[model samples]
Target: MDDPIMKHNVPDTEWFDRSSLRRMLRTYSLVYIKPDVGRKGNGIIRVKRLRAEEFEISYKQTTSLRSRDKVYSAIKELLNPDKEYIIQQGIDLATYRHRPFDVRVVLQKPLGKWRTTLMCAKLAPRRSSVVTNVSKGAKDYNLYRLLKGTDQRLNRSEIIRNLIDVSKQIAQILGSHFPLKILGLDMGIDKRGNIWFIEANTKPDCQGLKKIDRRLYRKYLRAKKIMRNG
Candidate 1:
């Protein structure tokens, strides 16, 4: 049972501190800094390392820069060079309502095989945050409601089915590539409806099931018959 989330740390990290991070950004042109133990979208910073005479810093939708000495001071105050943190390449996120949003696809293996049960679109609040997690002030828009728009072109059932299919594809890839199951996937769909996996969760939240889609519980009743009928 290899962990899917752990697999993202492949080929070893070259740099891990603000100094190293800043240097890496200078060498590579861009990088993303995320908290290793952060949850609910806290302490995530996106920085662009540059070769400018006065280097710049950016995080959580705000961009700024200080002198080299000041940059080191900020890093010393903000990051733990010895602790776990990640500096990843940035992705061009897709937009929803003029702001960025991400999809949370819930998956489960009732009897033995994986199945997608629910999908949610978490939209970031206007001018408030970079993440769309509810704790970050993002709204939980009903996938069911979005499926009802005639002008949207995608039919209700088709939309749901596509969501499920895309989720399954991701799960299968992770299982084969990383071998972790029961993942809560944060995915982004560009304006063209292309799916991009942002990250995977080992512990997927079931509260959304309890609060939003209780009827999905009944699907488990058939779990007993999954192997027998298959």
Candidate 2:
């Protein structure tokens, strides 16, 4: 988020704490709190402002609280004190048939140059689900279908092109600092078709990607082989 160009797509994020949580809730109706070293959407929390004082929070289950202190206490109780957390202003994700989803773009360094290897839509199993993580019961769908056929308000081609470019740029930026060979970026599309940078996984799971696109999955395997044995 330090990059001026990248920060625009990145949501407003802050270290999870009472002050930051209260301040973000004042500006945005929804926010997400997650462990600093978490994956599979485990230990993630969703907070929504229902009224001036009343708030709705969802973790393992949904609950309502009347005060910021109460909300803080409730969330804190669910968190592991040994781990760190961050609060990010949530994106009102684009939905298909009322289920929210996000695009997962994987970029790999094949022969030492960054290129997008695969892209797929991870759809939440149900309407009320918080995270669209497959390990958390989400399903993968064809990205083109979700962006083009289901929704017309968004320019599907443009969104894909932009994210592809952004993903490559991100690989370049972060690769400069770390010896990274691959990056799995979680990109979100809001109800208005605007793209958002949700988060990135250094070691992304590509287990079921072949179910989305065989050719792309093969391309990913080739890249992995080249990077591993080159």
Top candidate, metric TM-score: 2
lDDT of 1 by residue, 1-230 (tens): 14454333221234466567666656554555666766776666655545564546665567777665566566456665555776665544455456666678777665557877667677778733546778867876665664343232444575566667767876876767665646787876544454556667877665654445456544533442563565
Give candidate 2 misplaced runs (Cα > 4 Å).
Answer: none
Which one is best on lDDT?
2
Query: What are the lDDT figures for the candidates, one per model?
Result: 0.60, 0.89
For model 2, how does the per-residue alpha-carbon lDDT over 142-184 read when each residue is reduced to its tens digit?
A: 8988886543378888888988988887788889999999999
Worst ten-residue run, lDDT, model 1?
6-15
State every prediction's TM-score relative to the real structure: 0.65, 0.95
* Model 1 misplaced regions, further than 4 Å: 1-30, 48-63, 66-76, 80-82, 144-166, 173-181, 209-230
User: What is the clash tally of candidate 1?
Assistant: 0
